[model samples]
Target: MSVSSVDDRQRAARLLLRHPLIRSTDEERYRLVRRYSSDLEEWFEINTGWAMHADSEVVRLEREPATVADPTHPFATRRGGAVLSRRRYVLLMLGLSVLERSDSQVALGRLAEQVIAAGTAPEFAAAGFSFDLSTREERSDLVAAVQLLLEWGVLVRVAGDEQDFVHKTGDALYDVSRRVLSQLLVTRRGPSTISAQTLDDRMVAMRDRGAAPTTELRNLRLRHTLTRRLIDDPVLYFADLDDEESAYLRSQRAALCRRITEFTGLVAEIRREGIAMVDLDDDLSDVRMPEKGTEGHVTLLVAEFLARSGVAEHFVASLVAHVRSIAPDFAKYWRASALEADAAADLVATSLGRLSALRLITRTGDIVRVLPALARFALAEPTILGGRKP
Candidate 1:
């Protein structure tokens, strides 16, 4: 490839990785992808086993969304965290349903009324969900879900503000980007069509039915799935892989890494326990480790503790204890009121959640196994008195 061609491919890769869904409103990035649409699509399909879709209204990359959640990711809003609480998640689904029924221009109050009616209906009430607009918490939650949609480009703000609704002061207006709304759900079946009652079952049933049934096709999908994981995650542990996946990945790992490197400029960092696509440029990932704050300090502390000799696994209770013991010294500097607790267990939970999300550690129930990547975080060598290399 020519120099410019290589740069364009990398730019396309970075754009899609940075913002997976590029709406028309994302003017600069959207235009960048538009100019390189063919190249981006070709690169994405050949390298990551995914598709890059582009049109006048939007540009999107189709890939399996990550299940991990971090409460402090920068892409998310100042108020919103990386992880959505269960209540907020339910509200999000409710908001989507409402959006589907809304016209091109959506009025905030109208949407709230419809959601309240549906949520308070006998069937929904029987299911244990209640929507009372009078309650500040309920209002805030629905607004949070709507704000999330706004951030995702599914709904564009044309008028009023969501903060008004949250404060019980006023309502907002929005324009529904139907093109973007349609692309929000990556599932094959609508929620109404699914027979599953629980979220997990429904999620499983929502997989694209177009997937071929043949064994050869299934094998192809397995390869695609594994490749996508490498491109998307910091690491892929063998313990997390299925038997067939492990076998396929073991045999075709080098080929997969080469294919990805050619397309996205990502280098493979392979180890015995897992494989990670190391983007030395740091342009691909949405989250980072060893951040700067109390959370970062706590993570470093935990990583150091785990990386130390004789430490194999960490328990939630033990981690909580550690955080509680040391929280006082850092509580004054902590930015989040949520983390400024007397015990700071929640802060510990958030840190561990982030660590797990980064793939530096694996969590099963209460126990966390520090992965190989974290070994590199060992405390820097002590500096000598003369500022000489130690």
Candidate 2:
């Protein structure tokens, strides 16, 4: 059978084993090696450690180590296994909101204002009192919060002299990093308290319905909600975030965006088309593969072009031309194939069939359209790369 015809379950298992964590687990590693020994050699490099164990003895484990990290590397840390305190998690959520809402050069005072608005203002107003946090202790709390944010790299202090300090304006606004917020907001809630049997039942139910796994969807939703929340909330200011924390938060946000996009693309493909083997094509060979899972990417590209062109489809060609001129990075991703250019008139006809299957996007002929849900993914928040509603 062709590589494209490989069983998806087998493929997924192979993919799972590619992870360092999974490979470290003797049972899972051996099971994969046993069932697909030939495929395994092509897909992975087995270590001497794995060579010593018999394949049959490996399948008894209830859990497997994560595959994303290198087990043999001394410095390689396990992914998604670290425990975070509730307080830190709360701060992370708040920080994400701040990053999402504020733009570069946001004032510290503004962040304090938002925090007070969200947490304290209503109580004070109801008591018929003019509440002011001008005291040292109150100011310290604000400082502490901002410092935390800064340390996370979500916010940066504006530079100035000593006079900038004495003015005590506390106006030290921060430049919010949307990427940082996006990452923090997507922090996962651990496995449910549900029993293992119940979980297995749910997985079985999903399989019966020919549905993509529910666990995958749940994780996607969690990330999506976080991204949406960040875009909707007020930004955390520099004074609220310290240097170290600010950097950390920024890295997280970047990672989140990259993962979200990848996951979105992968899930959309799976939902629209059943599992199929993916052989990364580097030679640009002309292969007759089934159309699936590419609609969202295409729609996004077209919609972005249309939106920038004032929502008129008539100017699509001109818009495409303009994108080529002004946004080369975007152009590289959206460029049509040589065959597409050769069959210009037929391109739309060919693409429509594939675009329709994903359901995440809508298209009328060549005029790309996006559904409300898909549109949310494309929304641009000044704070986030693609904005979402709260």
Candidate 3:
């Protein structure tokens, strides 16, 4: 048979297979056979070696199930299967490095230098950055990577010509949301649990207390203050702090300001910007006023006065006379007269404890230092300002 005839027969066979009934009246059977004659002929030619009966062949084809492609199979169209390439990983690391070093602008040459210093191979750094190249292909990859980071809102490139492109001020620095590089640097890790003796043994030979040590107590005190300052400043950069204590300092972040004026302004600014204050007293009217004769109330009142005055040590007689004059009701309530020596001593001890608990004053061997928070509070409160609480 001709190739075209064979193709027509195959098409007829498909149509015949789609039909239901096989047996019928002689006339009906004749019509059906005539209609599917090309189909039967095609089936016969294709299955010639099988020598199967027409009914059996029809049953076999009908019983067979259709083959289907699996839905779960890995296809090129599926998402989340693409792995990050090595070059992309390196670029990400470089971007992080740039963020760690600078907040404002970072030049391509400088970034390349940092990457090289960070132990990336020289060739990779050289290929990644160009000081002179202005062509699209040469610069496209780096620019694209930076643009991707900018789109992610983790970086921003300053507006300029291609050759003059630099990271924007405060753009190179990012709040690294994840601890991706914690293990990469030793300083990024937490404080070691090693004992002082072990640390000394590892660093230098054992020395007597009389021996001149590398770290003196005064130096340690200075280091502690400096480290504390870094932790307390939100805008402080890691580069601004000493590397040896950076991790420790980074861990101990308190409320950003130590001074009352700074704290109040910051709080007021936050409130003005519609930021809700956390852990604040909601009802100003509900503030408990100190009562007379109550040891706790009298102690708090005395401490508040001394803290307000910014005086550490007051003469016992002077403090008693002052308290008696200011809080005459409290003096009248006192079972022991304000002039009594025992009453004066009791007042002082109670006041000291109350003030220390409030962190208003620090007592070291009878000397007290006023905390800045308390000093600010004194300035704000009417009672401390020599006026009655409204």
Off by over 4 Å in 1: 46-49, 66-82, 208-216, 324-341, 380-390
How well does candidate 2 match the true structure in TM-score terms? 0.25
Q: How high is the CA lDDT of each candidate model?
A: 0.75, 0.38, 0.41
Question: lDDT ranking from best to worst?
Answer: 1, 3, 2
lDDT of 3 by residue, 1-390 (tens): 676655454344333333322322224443544555545644433322111123311211221111112111111111332333445455555656665655355555455456445635565566674232244443433454454444333443443433333332222322331222222222211233333444444232212123335655534433444422322221233443465545443443333223211222222122111111221322211112243455656666666677678665655556555555655566556665654645665667666655554434556664666654354346444454567768
Clashes per model (N, Cα, C within 3 A): 1, 37, 0
Which residue ranges in model 2 land beyond 4 Å of their true spot? 1-95, 121-132, 160-170, 188-390
lDDT of 2 at 60: 17
Preferred candidate (lDDT higher): 1 or 3: 1
Supply the TM-score for candidate 1.
Answer: 0.85
- For TM-score, candidate 1 versus 3, the one ahead is 1
For model 2, residues 196-226, the per-residue Cα lDDT tens digits are 3554564433323233367655444334333
Error of 2 at 285 (Å): 50
In model 3, the runs with Cα more than 4 Å from the true position are 1-293, 312-321, 324-329, 332-341, 379-390
Reference-based TM-score of each model: 0.85, 0.25, 0.25
